[model samples]
Target: MKNTLKISAITFIFSIGVLAQEIVDETLNTQVDANIPGVVAQKEIDNLDDQAKKLYYEFKDTVSEYEGLKRYDDQLEKIVFSQEDEIRDIIRQIDSLDNVNKEILPFLKETVDSLRKFVNLDMPFLKESRIARIDDLDSIILQSNVTTAEKFRKVFEAYQLEAALVIPLKHTRIYRA
Candidate 1:
């Protein structure tokens, strides 16, 4: 009789545990069904998040570009302002013609002297031609007839021509023959 009671108790507990497990499984299944749509929606949210990150990085790049452009513009404006000031000062100096002459005459003389020396020391291919240009500049630089602007222009022209020209090699034996 005691064995029969213990076996009955064991069977009853076992049946109750099975019933509870079935109820829990049914609840879990219902919850999983309810969350199926959310799982699908989460994928779309994740895609949107990826797009937002991509746009954020692009926005960062654009902002950096804008900042670089701003810095460049600021630097350009500074250069323009500085150049305008220099131009104004130059115009003021031009108004004082004597002062301009006093300042520029020595420099022009030195430039001519240096040019003559350079021509002499340079390759002899165009020696006479370059020296003649220097001499012409010297003559005009001091001439009262030539305007100072014209004198300076001629000097600059000569210097430009000298710098821009390509002198050919001297033919020693062939020219001598």
Candidate 2:
């Protein structure tokens, strides 16, 4: 009995489906008739509109970036122009530095030599060490690695040490007797 009922239900559903085909669209050809010249599907129109919107936004972003680049270029030009005087001043300083370096080398050499002669002729306290220091200074001045400024600084420090040695630290001598 149950099998008979199931067969009847299937037959009824099949008959209804066959009759319902006339109500629905026959094929995709009827959905877009060949006779129409410019008719397109609603889904295609929606997709085209979306693509157009995306392109429009991209173009807007590109234009904004171009304007930003234009501003940056203008600012860069201004900075270059503003720095011209400073650049010239720095260049002059550098040129003068080279001249000073040339003039000072001979003076430094003479000073070092004079100090060496004085130390040799004077009383012999730490004499060898003093001569070694002068020798080191001579090598430092001649070295390509040491800058003129650094050599000058070293010479000044040596002069300070010599001055301290010559000058007494106290005016009154300590009488511990």
Candidate 3:
């Protein structure tokens, strides 16, 4: 009976050890499965962060381009308005000219000088060839021994030519900021 009891006690301890080992293995497997989803979630979050950073930079670049276009448009507008005002003044002066007024000759020269200065300073890209042609005509008018009417006609012709060159540029669409 004593031997039988000792054998039963030993068997019970062995059974408990096997159960404990099985429980520990099951816990380890559950822990591993839980960690796999966490790792995948972290990877997805990192990818999303990278994509957001890329989009932010792209937006910034687009905004910068828009701002540059706006500035260019504003400059073009200023040039058009200034040129229009100058042309109108020239037309008014021509309409009021009398044939025998030598004083009007000096005024015409001054008007041409002002127009040339304005073009050079404000509209630098307005075809240089056209500007030169207009300048040549102005010089001829300034030095010619002609009536005020003749000078006015020549100046008016040059003014019309310059206006033709400027008008197309004015209607061009400017980009928005």
Q: Rate the local accuracy (lDDT) of all candidates.
A: 0.86, 0.85, 0.79
Model 1 Cα lDDT, one tens digit per residue, 1-177: 999999999999999999999999999999999999999999999999999999999999999999999999999999999999999998887788878888888888888888888778876767888888898888888898888778778878877776765442343334453
Roughly what TM-score does model 2 have, to 2 decimal places?
Answer: 0.57
Per-residue lDDT tens digits for candidate 2, residues 1-177, read 889899998888887887677545555466557535345466678889999999999999999999999999999999998899789999999999999999999889998998899788866768888899999989998998999989999888888877776666335365767
Clashes of each: 0, 0, 0
Sort every candidate by lDDT, greatest first: 1, 2, 3
Worst 10 residues of 1 by lDDT: 166-175
Best by TM-score: 2
Looking at model 3, the pairs that clash are none
Over the stretch 93-156, how does candidate 3's per-residue lDDT look in tens digits? 8666543356777777886777687577655665587568667767777564766677778777
The best candidate in terms of lDDT: 1
Query: In model 1, which regions exceed 4 Å deviation?
Result: 1-95, 166-177
What TM-score, over all chains together, does every model reach?
0.40, 0.57, 0.45
Single out the weakest 10-residue window by summed lDDT for candidate 3.
Answer: 94-103
RMSD of each: 15.5, 11.9, 23.5
